[model samples]
Target chain A: MSPLLEVNELQIAFGGVKAVNGLTFSADAGEIVSVIGPNGAGKTSAFNCITGFYKPVSGSITLDGKDITGKRPAVIAATGVTRTFQNLRLFPDLTVLDNVRGGMHLYGGQNFVDALFHTPRYRKSERFYTEEAHRWLDFVGYQGGRGIPVRNLAYGQQRQVEMARAMARKAKLVLLDEPGAGLNHSEKQDLLELCRKIRDLGAAVVLIEHDMGVVMEVSERVVVMNFGKEIADGTPDAVKKNPAVIEAYLGKADEPVKADEPAKAEGPDITEGDS
Target chain B: MSDNVDTTRAPRRIGKPASRISRLFESRQLGWAAFAIAVLFPFVLASNYAMSIGTTAVIFILLASGLNIVVGYCGLLDLGYIAFMAVGAYTSGIIAKAWELPILFTIPAVVIMCILAGLIIGGPTLRLRSDYLAIVTLGFGEIIRLTANNLAITGGPSGIYGIPGVDLFGLDLSGPVPFYYFCVAVVALMVLGSARLGKSRLGRAWRFVREDEDAAEAMGIHTYKVKLAAYIFGAIWGGIGGVLFAAHLSAISPQSFVFLQSALVLMAVVLGGMGNTRGVVVGAVVISLLPEFLRDMGNLRYVIFGVVLVAVMVLRPQGFWPSRAYEPEKLDEARKGKRDGGPRPGAPVTTAKGGTP
Candidate 1:
């Protein structure tokens, strides 16, 4: 079967700058792939292009062998691609449960007429929506009050809500942008396990993360980028040892150390590159 | 690590007395109370002037509810909502006069015209956000009124007259008392429908769009289509109100559907509380009746009205009855598990803060 998502020769530019240039990647069902790179590496930009938030200058994005390039975000989302933003984008005024129900918008069994009249179908569908929202919130281990506005939750709790919202889509492919940012070590570990669980549920999971620990622990395959170009692609062990990956993470030096030696230094170096 | 987290979630609170008043207003009892008052008002007053004012207030309530769909629920700023009302009134008025039919019989045609009007105005303008949308809708409102003023079928500036009263099941509802009750029933049903729509899936989508369009789109809501749906619903409600407006007056005129009328309807939505149906109804009643009650003030009634509105805004920017945001509580075993010493079955271990396994 064709991969769940495939992008080929994707190029997008903003005025004079090429945010993503001829980047290519593919993810399959039941796989967890991480895209890790230095800041301005165009990871988020590429994710935006695939999700239809940003129109690419030239390329093809196909989902299950169907071209979906440049489609509206809602249209692309309807085809089973769901994502979380780098910043927590939970509706601040909406309750946590409502925020998650938002992901289930396309899974419709009722329309405006049913809503106006409060038909049995409307009640049934709404009940299902609420139940599923609670289920996903539970799955993500959100301990905050589901009835309160998400703005009331701590930043880390809000991140969990955003993940639950994305997962609530029940999509075939899920893209998480910096899912581990601002998370404590324990939360990051939980996120790792959640990624695996998502893959086990027969969905493709792609994440852009700065936390090397998460990228290395959770990703079955890793793709590294720098300046909008894919510089390395392999298993975590292989990518860690790639000379170019090391050079990109830690600026060029007189002597190239072994992969294990620079592992501790990689985190700070990546943080330095972010600014 | 969670000690300073402020995890003791407190129930959201407004001011003490305000919260109590809001709770009272939010209850189903308020709807019943309003309905009862509407039913009993004519009996107590009985005068033609009082009945007329009451009937007009009922129609105003319908107008406010319709505008609520677009402005309050969907967060579309409509400056020319009166245009939809005009479309409905004119379509029904012309059909009733030309066909010699009761105004009630022209409802199907009125609905179609309102939908068309909604599409015509909402299609192009829904793309523009905020202030631009306000400008375009204001233009459409004026354009609709001007077209009616110049059209012979609409009787130009004089508009259509001698429009027959609404007849239901051979019962002539032309008398003031009977018509007032009829308006009450119909307006009650329409208000109920609008409130029901506010709780539906589409309503949630509207709120989502209102809150964050980009996030709403990312969640698979077609923001444009959702917005257009709000516009159409608003148009239909306004159109139906127009049918009642025509029936109430037995005549239609361009002078009635002016920009100030639209502003008054908007003021009702804002003053009552934008998304709360009960508040909108209350706002409509207050806006429509306050002037009648202040008639002794002569021309200064409007100035007082303006001052009162400004005072209300200054005191409660959220309106009289702000829409309540709620979440349905399910069986929360996790919270239970926290209190007890045992972990809930199937509960993820990661919920324990600092327990990095």
Candidate 2:
């Protein structure tokens, strides 16, 4: 079967800087992939390009074997790709259930006339939306006031709400941007299981994470990126042993190893001269 | 960890007393009470001037509710909303006079013209955000009024007069009391329609767009289309109000569609509470009737009205009847059902190990 999402030779630039350059990756259904890198390693930039937030200078993005590159975010979302921002972007003033219902926008079972008249169709659709919103909130193990505005919830709870909102989309592919950031220990645990649950739902899951522990524990495969390019792609064990991956996270060794030298041979040429 | 969650999750209700008061106002009983008062107003005050003012206040309620759709529900600041009203009034007035037909016969023309007006004003301006949008709409309002002022068909500066009263079926709704009741019924229906629209799926999309445009877009809502829908709905409401205004006055003029008219309608929406239907109605009534009520003071009345408005703004920036921001607890109960038990008491705290599988 075709991969759920495929990004090929993607490039995005701001002025003279290439934020994401020639990045390629594919995520299949029922798999958890973690994209790990240092700060400004362009992981988020690549995610943005994939999600249609940033138009890439050049590349092709296919979801479920259909080209979706450069589509508007809403259009891309309708094609069964949903994402969460690095920063929690919950509708702060809306109720927790409303925030999750945001994901169900494409589920249009009622129109303006139905709404204005309060027809049976409108009532049925509204009831379905509310029930689905609650189910997703519970799926994420959210233990907060469902009726209150999300702004009233604690930071960790807010994160869960965002996760629930993303899951509520029922998208074929889910991209979680730093879902573990700023989360406490127990919250992160809940998030880890939530990610697994997402994968188990038969949706392809790609997450950008900084926490190596969570990344190692949850991801089936790890794709390491540095300087806007992929440096390593393998199972968690193999990627961990890849010297280029080690050098990308920690600074280079005193003597560069021959095995991983090809991956970083042009690093000096690409690195701009800055102290 | 569980203990920490419990401590932070204290059941803190928001604005308990205020919500209770709002609930009372929001009840169907309040609607019935207001309807009864409207029904009995003619009996208490039989004077022509009193009846006329009451009719105007009802029309003004329609205008404010219309503006509430654009400003409150959709969060689009439209300053030229009066243009649609002008379109409706002029279309009906000209059609009724030139064709020698009853004013009620012009309803279809009024609706079509208002829709065209909505598109003309909203198509380009809705792309602009906040202040820019407001400025453009203000300009559009002036443009429409100026065009009406200059055009001969629209009666130039002298304006259109001798416009006939509405004839519904066989009954001539021309007299002060009959017309007052007619206006009351029409305005009440319009108000109910607007309120119902606010609770629909499309309405939720509007509020979502208001809260966060990008987030709403990411959720597959086309913000532009939703905003346009709001503008069109506002135009329809205003246009219908124009029909009532023309019928009540038996005349139409460019002066009636001035920036001040738009501002007053906006003021009603803001003073009452932007998103609250009941609040908007109350605000409209107060703004429309306060000057008439203070007519005994003559010149001092204007000064007092201005002072009162300013004081209200200072005291309650959220409006006299702000919309409540809470969801019902039905979803909470649904969630609890899935959890087997709700809010575990004295549940053991569990730590998440970094390397736990």
TM-score of chain B of each: 0.88, 0.89
Off by over 4 Å in 2: A255-275, B1-10, B15-22, B331-357
Query: Tens-digit lDDT track for model 1 on A45-90?
Result: 9999998999999989999888999999999998888999998888
The prediction achieving the highest TM-score against the true structure is 1
Q: How much is B127 displaced in model 2, in angstroms?
A: 1.8
Worst 10-residue stretch by lDDT in candidate 2 chain B?
B348-357
lDDT of each candidate versus the true structure: 0.85, 0.84
lDDT per residue as tens, model 1, B1-357: 223113423345322224576556557788899999999998799899999999999999999999999999999999999999999998998888887887888999998999899999999999999999999999999999999999888899988889888898799898999999999999999999999988888888998999889889988899999999999999999999999999999899999999999999999999999988999998999999999989999999989988999999999999988776654344333232334443322234345311111
Regions of candidate 1 where Cα sits further than 4 Å from its true position: A254-275, B1-23, B331-357
RMSD of each: 5.4, 6.2
Q: CAPRI band of model 1?
A: acceptable
Chain A only: give the TM-score of model 1: 0.92
- Candidate 1 residue B155 Cα shift, in angstroms, is 1.4
Best by lDDT: 1
TM-score of each: 0.91, 0.89
Structure candidate 2, residue pairs in collision: none
